[model samples]
Target: MTDKQISDIKNRIAVIAAWIVACLFFFPIFWMVLTSFKTELQAISVPPKLFFKPTLENFALIQERTDYTKFAWNSIVTSVGGTGLALIIAIPAAYAMAFNSGRWTKDILMWMLSTKMLPAVGVLMPIYLLSQKFGLLDTKGVLVIIYALINLPIIMLILFNYFREIPKEILEASRMDGTSTFNEITQIVMPLAWGGIASTALLSIVLCWNEAFWSINLTASDAGTLPALVASFSSPEGLFWAKLSAVSTLACAPIVVFGWLCQKQLVQGLTFGAVK
Candidate 1:
């Protein structure tokens, strides 16, 4: 066979492999949505039912059982708040690290990332106690702070990579033109790196939104997010598989739609530095 024929076959194999991986990753989400429409018995039947009478009863019951809007509002507030805070902090830090290098800069970055490797549960008690001592437990503000800290290293790292990819000469010209640091960032650097910033902010928000551990442990009804609401589905009696699926579906739907809508921007931001 010609070399071109071999290359074509390899490309086809890669495409098929990619499709299989995508489907595998997507299957659990598909099952959850399907199970949401089933009756509790059908959801847990000896053999999982793929085709059954779908119903809106679980969704309706979820609304009646809890304040869906309130939980959703909390989620929105915390995720956006956290992402905003992270960007405010990460931008300056990333800028310094990217442009004003020092011997320990890489070490500092590694240390920051190392914190994430520690199991969250290991420090849960100290954080919990501190929150209690400060009278900040079960508040949206506290959740926002926690989420920002949790996602900061990743945000900073992404922004740093993006910043490094930009040409230094552009900033040098601006500096020679008497541009102040604040203006340099707000006017020059930010504009040039908008794609990276947007993508970084989007990722941070998604991470914050999907955070269940802090949301469940720190917040009660007053500040509980959708994840907390999902956790509430468990009772002493037993788990309600169908209703849990229903709540999970509702919790996931908004983010999924938001992601789909902003996919172009997300892809562009993530790939901004790849070519050059």
Candidate 2:
């Protein structure tokens, strides 16, 4: 075959492969949303009926059973607050590590990253005890603090990588102009690295929003987040697939929508230094 024709065929195959992967990833989500509209019987029907009458009863039942707004508010507070706190801490830490490295800098970074390898359950007992001892259990502040700590390492790594890509001459020039440390970050590094920061913040926020482990174990009705609400649908008898699906959909909707809205920023931020 001619070179041009061969390239065209390869492109077609790549496109087809991409579509298949996308569909595979999206199918579970589509099924969850579809099942949310089904009745309990329909949700678990033999052959998994693709065609059935849809109803809002499951959603209505969820609303009637508990205060969704409260859970949603808690999720919003924790996710945004946690992400904000993590960024505030990560930015400076990453900046120093990137520009002002010492002999133990790489070791410190490795140690921070290693913390993530430890299963969260391993530390749950200690964390739970600390929370209880401090009278911070079931409080938004506790979740925010935990979320920030858990996400801190990744955030710092991401920001550190991005910061390293920046031209040091720009920062040095800022210093020559008598810029203070805070202004050097606020006026120069921040503006330049905004994309990476936004992408990191978005990722951290999503992680915080979807966190269920700590939320479930640490909080009760007072501070239960959306993931906790989804977990609440379970009982000893069995899972109510339909109602569970409905609540799951409600819980996922906000993050999904927010992600869609910020997709451009996410993409741009992730690819900030790819070309240059």
Candidate 3:
């Protein structure tokens, strides 16, 4: 084959491989969605029935059993609230670490990153006890705080990298122009790093939304999120596979859509410095 023709063939093969990988990753979600519409018998049938009549019964059953709206609202509040708090704390911290070098800065950053490696369960007892002592258990505010702290390291690291990429001369110029640090961030740094901030926020929101352990343990009926709502499907009688699928599907839909919408930004932010 001619060289150009060979290159085109290789490109097409790569595209096909990518599509196959995408399909493999998406298969479980597709299966869950499909099963959500099937009856329990149909859902568990040997050689899974792909051509069964779909029904809304599972969804109706979920609604009757749980307050879907309340759980969803809790998820929204906690995720958004946590993300907002993380950003509020992360932006300035990242800006300082990025622009202002100090002796312990790198060590501090590494220590922050190291915290994420520690098992959350190891500290769960202390956090839970602290929360209880402070009357913060099962409160939306507590979950928001926990989520913010959990995500803070990652947010700071991401924003710090993005901020570092901005030309120092630009900030120096702003300083020469008599702009305060607050104005530098709000007016200058933020506008320039808006894309990175947005992607960081998107990531933090996703992490907060999918957090099941803390949500389940920290909150009871009052502040339970979608994950908690999904957990309600478990019973001593055994799992209701179809209804569980329905609940899982419902819980996942919003975040899935949100992630899809912001996927480009997420990719861009993650790869911000890769090219440069």
Best by lDDT: 3
| lDDT scores of the candidates, listed in order | 0.87, 0.88, 0.89
The TM-scores of all predictions, comma-separated, are: 0.84, 0.86, 0.89
Error of 1 at 18 (Å): 5.5
lDDT of 2 by residue, 1-276 (tens): 999999999999999999999999999999999999999999888999898989999889888888888899999999999999988998988889989989998899889988888898999999999999999999999999999999898888778878887899999998998999999888888898887888888878888999999999999999999988877777831368888888889999989998998886666444433333
Off by over 4 Å in 1: 1-21, 41-53, 236-238, 260-276
Q: For model 2, where is the 10-residue window of minimal lDDT?
A: 267-276
Where does the lowest 10-residue lDDT sum fall in candidate 1? 267-276
Supply candidate 2's per-residue lDDT for 31: 95
lDDT of 1 by residue, 166-223 (tens): 8999999999999999999999889999988988888777778889999888889999
Better of 2 and 3 by TM-score: 3
**1-276: candidate 3 lDDT, tens digit per residue:** 999999999999999999999999999999999999999999889999999889999899888878788899999999999999989999999999999969988799889978888888999999999999999999899999999999998888888888988999999998998999899999999999988899888888888999999999999988999988877777742367888889899999999998889987777555533333
Model 2 CA deviation exceeding 4 Å by range: 1-21, 236-238, 260-276
Segments of candidate 3 deviating more than 4 angstroms:
1-18, 236-238, 268-276
Error of 2 at 59 (Å): 1.7
Report lDDT (Cα) of residue 212, candidate 1: 93
C-alpha lDDT of residue 133 in model 3? 99
Best by TM-score: 3
In candidate 3, which residue pairs clash? none
Clashes of 1: 0
